[model samples]
Target: MTEEPRLSAQDMIDRLSPVLSLRTRIRAVAALLAGVTGAVFMGTLWWTEPGPLPGRTHLAFALLTVFCLAWAAYGGWLLTRRIPLFATDQVIAAWIGLVASLATTAVVTVVAVQRGAGVGLPSAAGGVFVAVALALVVRAQARRAALLRRKHELTGREER
Candidate 1:
């Protein structure tokens, strides 16, 4: 018997269909907008303030921004490969990004408080909001994927 082929990353992206269609483009756009807005807010706080931002705090914010951009960029890249793959990968990346942001925010908040920097509160809040938004976006994409799969199943049954 012939062995089943193992899928490479690019092959997987090529095989899966996107869960979100043109109707759901708004979700991707929202994710991008939220990511950019959070990045701008955190960047401003980190770079323009009078007192130096604590090293940990600066790094956390920077990582948060990078993850956001990565999520967006990955989603865009996946879209050209396969739509379903794009949705699946986007959800996975968003979840990882959220967790990383939350962990970083927690570490930075504790460090900033220890250093007597009260300004870290705003930063912490911003990080939390970004994490929450990312999580929500992932949930939305998952739901959309499920709906699409169901529709495809129904259509296939009718065709058969």
Candidate 2:
């Protein structure tokens, strides 16, 4: 019996297929773009006086901006490192959905709190829950699409 040599991480990277690398780099570009967009918007919105925006509104935007930029950086970093064994594209998409929803919820909750509505926080939480649930659904669909694509590539036949 012959024994095979173990491959190092660098060796694996060196052997990575051009197609996979291209795909990953595309995702990375998307993440970087999102980060840049968030930064631009945040800068434009907060650069000058808020113009009657309450304190809570400022906090909400700041939190949302932070989340947006952070996730974008994380996604780009993962793609650059080719670490998608766990953080797959579908997972990234879901995270994007969840993050956007959470930001929206933050704004809504702030408005609700400012209005003195005792039920606002719970309602905002419920909205976030729904958004996450929808993202999960999207993730499942994405997984299915990827599987179908792989199957097509392997069999040279498209599944109806």
Best-fitting candidate, scored by lDDT: 2
Candidate 1 residue pairs that clash:
17-83, 17-84, 18-83, 18-84
Give me the runs in candidate 2 sitting further than 4 Å from their true place. Answer: 2-21, 50-53, 87-89, 113-129, 132-160
lDDT of 1 at 120: 60
lDDT of 2: 0.68
Best by TM-score: 2
Predicted candidate 2 versus true structure: per-residue lDDT over 40-96, tens digit per residue:
788677767546877776776687678668767866765657332423555656666
Per-model TM values vs. the true structure: 0.47, 0.56
TM-score of 2: 0.56
lDDT for model 1 comes to 0.65
For residue 73, give model 2's deviation from the true position in Å: 0.6
Q: Which stretches of candidate 1 lie over 4 Å from their true place?
A: 1-20, 78-82, 105-109, 112-160
